[model samples]
Target: MQFHHHGYVSGDPRVRPAAGVGINRPAELPDEVDVLIIGTGPAGMLTAAQLSQFPNVTTRIVERRAGRLAIGQADGIQARSVETFQAFGFAERIIAEAYAITEMAFWKPDAADPSRIIRTARTQDDPAGISEFPHLIVNQARVLDYFAEYMANSPTRMSPDYGFEFRSLSVSDEGEYPVTVTLLQTSGPNEGQERVVHAKYVVGADGARSKVRESIGCTLAGDQANHAWGVMDALAVTDFPDIRTKCAIQSGTGGSILLIPREGGHLFRMYVDLGEVDPNDKGAVRNTTIEEIIGKANEILHPYTLDVRNIAWHSVYEVGHRLTDRFDDVLPDERGTRTPRVFIAGDACHTHSAKAGQGMNVSMQDGFNLAWKLGHVLEGRSPESLLSTYSAERQVVAKNLIDFDKEWSTLMAKKPEEFENPSELEDFYVSTAEFPAGFMTQYAPSMLVAAADHQELATGFTVGKRFKSAPVVRVGDTNPVHLGHHATADGRWRIYVFADTALPGATSSTEEFAEWLASSPQSPLAATPSGADPDAWFDVKVVYQQGHPSIDFGAVPGVFKPQVGPFKLADYEKVYATDPAADIFELRGLDRGGVLVVVRPDQYVANVLPLTATAELGAFFAPLLPERKAAAVLSAATEP
Candidate 1:
């Protein structure tokens, strides 16, 4: 939201003045580029959005579709995705238009009648209150449109190249652009024509039947779960009281339905259990008709009746759980010496039942995680070793998602009598709510993610997991805000220094630490290119335990008020005071003495340390950040 640093912005601030590659950008695909991403799905669009932040890197994304996705199959927006939308500067807008899932009701056959259905239990969607963001239900296409708008207004002005279908790609160890790709024109005058492009790295977000995955010899290696479900987005009138509410209904003899209320109030999606499919009847379930699905739904409801008005969309899908061995082209034998040039993401890496509502949420995270690493490596901000961590971290997360979805999908497919306890479905849903809400993903220890040896320093800010936001008051404006909200997807590491019980500018631990960070050559701030913004490479902010009234804004350290933009205006938004009503220190379990947290560009807590541990702080960022010598080479290579 901060603007006008360069000069007065009389026009809309959201539309940034395009620069570099965005200035009168080429109309056709380049012969060579920094990164080439395939597909315009959830993962692909997010990848483009993140890479758009780096104007210096030439990134191109192509989709087989003639234009943008009109209607996407996925609609479930988990709480974690809403947090990501906030980072991209569109959460409020999307939430305003999205359906907020507040509670979920479970239904079973009536014990007295056995022929009718009755509500068994009802639970809050976010019972644990894991995130301040809500569980949303919005169209997948709308999410893509938001990202597209953000990209258009970004410095890079990125947009997907439509009608270009990916055919194949090959990797070489010898050239700057090691990955050579073949694309087929699916529309326009060049239809059926083929062309070639080369890239330093390539990402395949091309979905389950990804051509990029096939060219890389990666296989989706799991079997069908022998269950089929018919899903439809419909406008219907029904006596079922929970039609507007999310419901899990299991009939005594018919089947089950996982009903999800959609955004426009009157519309909702239903995943009608089409019963188990025989192993030999692979594609048979797809033939299940909409009328048949409605009949099954009516049977499940028993005494209730549904008058279908309109059908927005419908599909029949067999539940299958599959995952690739690795997300990149690097073989197991080539792990040490080789760097991955061709990579796959989203459905290319993992596939599971859509019933869990995880397909889009998880895929978007795949793009978010990989884009930062690719940006770092391409821009020479980090070594090639950083690229290896993407597959290692995300592959494990995908596996965990598959496991959870498998259990949830199986439970939904069961008959009411099959469960030892009639409330088994509701119990399981309540118990593992966090996982489905997208807060349970914890990346294991790696070069990027540090071990939890110092976790107690900020117990709430768990390492290897997403940084949870807490309320704090900005010192300069005295406005209450979330600390994590200040951290955006701008490809800069965050250094959040939680000050000890001391006033700003005082001769205390915070003062000494701030001075050293602003002056020390070993500090991560030194990595910022000369004449660039002081916080170009690292965003340094300080939060004090003291209330806003006790702090003098002018006395805050220079590190928290670094001069930015052409005017060299002091950025006063970095200094914050704990909210009196909800102190972040107590809420997040931060050590009263002081603690320094290192958060990656993706908003995951990377490391935690004592504020006075200057050497430890320097050591942590030393390897991740580029030295002046390496940055100079990057400058020369990137010069226009």
Candidate 2:
């Protein structure tokens, strides 16, 4: 038998405040397209690429910039972001050219010698076992380049039209494209010329001054951070040993500086503390240039020699933390009916200091979270209510991010005397150590994520949190594979049967597991109409402690892999058993078996229950999914 990858996409977004709504049908959508993405940054491009997985979904992306970005943007890719990248096949491309920042060294002025700075602490950049990849560095422009290449190769492809600016979006009564977009050409011969485009959905990936956000009536609320920072991405000459590594340098007199090693030609990125700059002063921000930033770097790293051989790009920015109150929105048509046709992501929805590198990664993750839900609704597989989760999840993440940036940016600007408070420093460092890895993000329970009450279930692999991956072996073959590889982010909800058939003192029988699966009324996914697409609806698979020698491959029951044809299996693509090479079960806190876990399309644990609790599973999905009129079908079949 040959194995092939099933085209898929996964979603992982952030936390948001709670609100309530039932799914309401739009009056109608026009004949234009399924999706339209505005602003071709990582957020917009990623949303376009993921939409390509659905063959029937039509997509278009537009950019206001004259061309691709040259420089000066977010560059850090955390562990969770790497996993998200791997889903789209761009992780290796980045890893090939980009620098993987594994170790972080912190420097402070020597206690007895105030003039010289010494290493205070050194540790791994990411927590162990968080992900397969670590924190990585590449310019934001290069990241956009990778997204462009992926979109070019997608099965359902769309290219971005540059120099196009979005003017406004209006809701329509009915047809294919319900949302009408007004666009203006911003550059070239067609500059100032206007045109109109129709789309069923419009995503705003424009920057902080997002017109889409304003047009839709969303407001950003937060205070400007007191510190001013200078960021420089350049190819430079330096004698610092840890310059090659990502480091935090704290000066006794001048201020603090952060080092980020880039991928191309020995480039390095620096964020230098420029002290307090007036928030109202636009000239203050514009006046600080590459030379000014370089001079500041010299002040911070006094003992270490520095020279800028060639600066690629630089910017002077104040830490102004602001976030929108909402993420998902329903724009009113001329008559004022609400439909969730307009949305926003990335810096458009939230803006803050570049210190944590969450801007690019979080924006892309938002795209990943939303694209598939739109794909399902456009294809008529899922209910419109699913769209509400986007605002619910991502807004929480944005709020948490703003709160964190407040403490961190303040500490970076404070004098050494303020660092004497060990508790405050420890709290800030604890967050610094955790949040950037992209693992700390967790969503609260709502309509989508129904689960057993278990928060400490194996340390972070709880209900409403991300489903971590593990290594297991195939039943017919001893080949080892990470279970996560099978749970591709391609937008399929999964029900995992952690089979304990071979475990000692196990009370649950294989027959019981098989029976529950075979009965439509008893299975959690029983509500899905019989004719529904398996690829789009739900996937069933099993994992076990070990395969019993007594039961031959042919003797394995039909529930594990069902049969519709002569001697063919039904559901099981591959049977996975524990692998001895790695103690993955222990690592993920899944050593105890005989449980059932329901995972959302975005790869988060939606529910966890006993293997026998199929009814609970059915109840969980009942509210969120469309129901099948099975009785009508059965009546027609009987009459025929």
Candidate 3:
């Protein structure tokens, strides 16, 4: 059987003597899917896994490669990515499989400078009060495997249709779920088949060379540095005590080198400047041949003599820094609307130097940010305009990463003479915390406009909200329960009752609010009798003064309101202070019956409505509550 469509052929063609190859195409095609994600990397896979939890939507992932491999790529997980892993339900197992790097030591290569040997540790003792998760070092493939396992266990079993590569896409301006994709299955037993996939939305997570991005005609706009770096993964047989510690060794003769410890005993990654090696040579570094790379490594670590043996895997590649000019196209005059019904994220959206190990984390978070919005819109719970926020929110994140990568690349390439000022080194450390933490916050809903005000917020209560999406916190305990451990299947809006104590007013407020929410026609909140019930729609918890659970609060400064603060009337003063404006009540038209804080699905405060404003509740939820009737009407009107 042969199938053919648009110059591509699949299957065996048995035509006379020396016949041409034939192609096969499926007769039926899916009319439209909730989401069509391109690429099977961490970004695409995780998005598919998150969306698979929603039964009402269909999620598909496509990959160019046919199978998973054990090669090590990214070897470290920042504290934030670990927290994300917790949400995806694989933090513990990942922690067990990865090596924990507690300390990082930097050394100077000159034997003449003994002081450089004891370079101050960036994080001497394991950082305290930084995050719930510690810094972990694991292979990138292992992390991908974990996600693959989770998706397989899920009811949806989100396996990518491998060998199927995206060829091109067509978009509609009429806005009737505007994107259609043409895909070709290029390999495997049933290779050369063509299929058309129609989707309400498309996510371009197809890595640096994304075909989806190409179809959209979006160019990544940023600088690409000329430097090439050699990355080697090997086991060190050296007697150096600090070999066990992650370190950066800078030698005058050779070049700058970075050493990282991996999961297995003594396995380490050595990054060297390719300028130090002969450009024409291409060789693999393994346990037996690792000694060849060690000579250059020794030159980089001049004062400390090192031995190399037992190498696992290694590769060399050029590094670059490039960020897309726009996250997605914004059509003129359509202030809140995005074009093509298509979005690009992850490496597809931005590519930068890999010094800080941010590519994986940022890419994963990008998927996280896009997945929820796509799921909700496909399920008919949110407006198509909701998709616009992905670009609005993540574009900033992409820019920040590019900027940090530039600075970090400079810092890594700095000479010992430039490091005389301790303040300069301190600034680099501060920058590290800032970039990763900021990227992590993009996944948080509290940073969005809808999460700004809690009362009028529609989607804030679901798994999408930052507070609700974040790990669980015991009322009095400092340690938090991983949010991933909780059952987050319900798609209802969440109402968190922040109260002083179990007073009559507090109890009455909680009960009345629950009752009102249960009865309100516009309310998406569901009533549950027991607070501890796993299947409860509305999550209610009282935060008392003595031992209240402290929220992560994310990167934005003023999401939390302080109990005591002076009123600042000036614009500049308001911007400088961490406190919300004292007259915010007037701004949001709220009155104290314990203000109803409405946070959006993305977790940014949407509005602050008074608990007593029952009459205005309908208008508040107008945007979030699905207008099935309106959708039906629109569908009917738009139908051919």
Candidate achieving the largest TM-score? 1
- Residue 65 in candidate 3 has what lDDT? 74
> What would the per-residue lDDT of candidate 2 be over residues 1-640, giving only the tens digit for each residue?
1221222224211111111110121222223667878898888888887776666677778888888888747888877777777766677778888888877777777788756677777766654556777678877788788777666555554457788899998877787778889888898787898868888888999889888898788878888765788888878778777778777788887688988888864888999888876757765665777788898788778678688898777888778899987875653232124447889998999988888788888888788888888987887767777777787788898888878777677776677767666334434565467676776777788877764564333443578767787777766666677776566545678887776545422346544664555555535445455544323356666677664333345555444553322223244454667777665456666536466777877777888766666667677777666664443332222110
Whichever of 1 and 2 has more lDDT, that candidate is 1
Clash number for candidate 1: 0
Ten contiguous residues with the weakest lDDT in model 3: 569-578
Which structure is stronger by lDDT: 1 or 3?
A: 1
Clashes (backbone N, CA, C under 3 Å), per candidate, total 0, 21, 35
Candidate 3 lDDT tens digits, 95-115: 887887676676654456633
- Give the per-residue Cα lDDT of candidate 2 at 263: 83
Q: Comparing candidate 1 with candidate 3, which one achieves the higher TM-score? A: 1
TM-score between candidate 3 and the true structure: 0.73
Per-residue lDDT tens digits for candidate 1, residues 426-525, read 9999999999999999988888887888899999999999999999999889999999987888999999999998898678898898877776777777
Candidate 1 residue 337 Cα shift, in angstroms, is: 0.8
**Superposed Cα deviation of residue 54, candidate 3 (Å):** 1.3
Ranking by lDDT: 1, 2, 3
Per-candidate RMSD, Å:
3.1, 6.9, 13.6
lDDT of each: 0.90, 0.70, 0.56
Indicate the worst ten consecutive residues by lDDT in candidate 1.
Answer: 631-640
